[model samples]
Target: MSRSCSFSLCAHDWSAYQLAEQLGRGVAELWPSADRGRYAVLNRLAELGYVATRQELTGKRARTIYSITPAGREALAAWLGTPPRPPSVEFEGMVRVLLADQGSLDDLRATLQQTRESALANRDMFARYAAYISATGGTFPERRHLFALANTFMIGHYDHILPWTEWAEQQIADWPDTVTPASTNEAQVRDMLAPGREVWEHDHPDGA
Candidate 1:
């Protein structure tokens, strides 16, 4: 997904300070190449007429609050309307796991552990957002509905990854010293390993 979409969503219901903090945690660290800084991203959004800045004078000093403009919403909608590009994540941890056949089991464990740790961290992050939404009694029903969906996706993602990583760690820990390939695709190999779990493994006469 484009950075613009994430930024637009952040401004949808949050103040500038909140957005900056979230951007720092989510985008700045996740995609540092695309990000300059929190203020720079906000300013770019303003320059493009996709975000509006309002000056608010607090008791101490002035602050800037940003909101996504009509154009911004339209842009975001257009992005959502089209099919997204293929996933091209740059996570080196996964890259190591992909080429694990060339490396030692210890290296595989270390790389998968990194991914597992990352998944747990992200799980905690979204759990806080989920708690916030819950505490508010589902405030902003429409927007919060989508935010809740995103939170659910992230939570589910990590939930799956956590167990998968654990399973992978165990499998690697007990990997055969002279194992050879039985299948090419992971799903096929998984089915070869799993006795009767997946329905897709069945040859249905009705093709149902």
Candidate 2:
């Protein structure tokens, strides 16, 4: 995905620089490599039939914002209904977890401390964005909705990670002597059969 395309996808307006800034912010938040993040956005836009380019508007070099065609809006609506694919997690604490044997308890603690700080900072930023959305009425109507959704997602994300981090810290302090793998056979079996059950048994029992 090109940066241009990705920027266009999320933006209601088509300012290239603004798109670039948003791309940078997304890269930081999502932790993808710069090239990959830009390309992903471009690819998605292409798939949706939206072109990203700069053109002269009113004799000024301005981003020629392409309006979403009816088909494009329909595609976006369909895409929105599906859960976003999980971004690759590049969290530093996970690396520390893998190399915990190489480091002392203090090192682990520090790593976790830094991770928590980063999470809190991110939470604050999202909160601020949500506030901005509430304050500004003239920005994209859809953007206000997207901001709310992003805030909700961020809250859930923090809620999930904060607890896990706390649990991990406690576990490290207590220092388990043995690790046991839980049984996942039943869950795995259910997961494997879940699609067929939903599709064949529920949605199309008579083979439509």
The numbered model that scores best in TM-score is 1
Candidate 1's C-alpha runs over 4 A off are 1-16, 24-38, 86-90, 101-103, 138-142, 176-208
Off by over 4 Å in 2: 1-11, 24-49, 57-90, 174-208
Candidate 1 TM-score over all chains jointly = 0.65
* lDDT, model 2: 0.59
Q: How far is candidate 2 from the true structure (C-alpha RMSD, Å)?
A: 9.0
Task: Give the lowest summed-lDDT range of ten residues in model 2.
Answer: 175-184
Candidate 1 on 124-173: residue-level lDDT in tens? 98888788878884434556787777778778877988998898776655
- Tell me the tens digit of each residue's lDDT in model 2 across 1-208: 3433433554465554455566555335644555355534643665657554445565655545443445566666676689977767777787886677676677777777777777777777767766777888424566567557766887677667776677667655644321221132446447646867887777777867
RMSD of candidates 1 onward, in order: 5.4, 9.0
lDDT at 148, model 2 = 75
How does candidate 1 score on lDDT?
0.67
* CA lDDT, candidate 1, residue 145: 80
Q: Give candidate 2's TM-score.
A: 0.58
- Give each model a TM-score: 0.65, 0.58
Clashes of 2: 7
Clashes of each: 0, 7
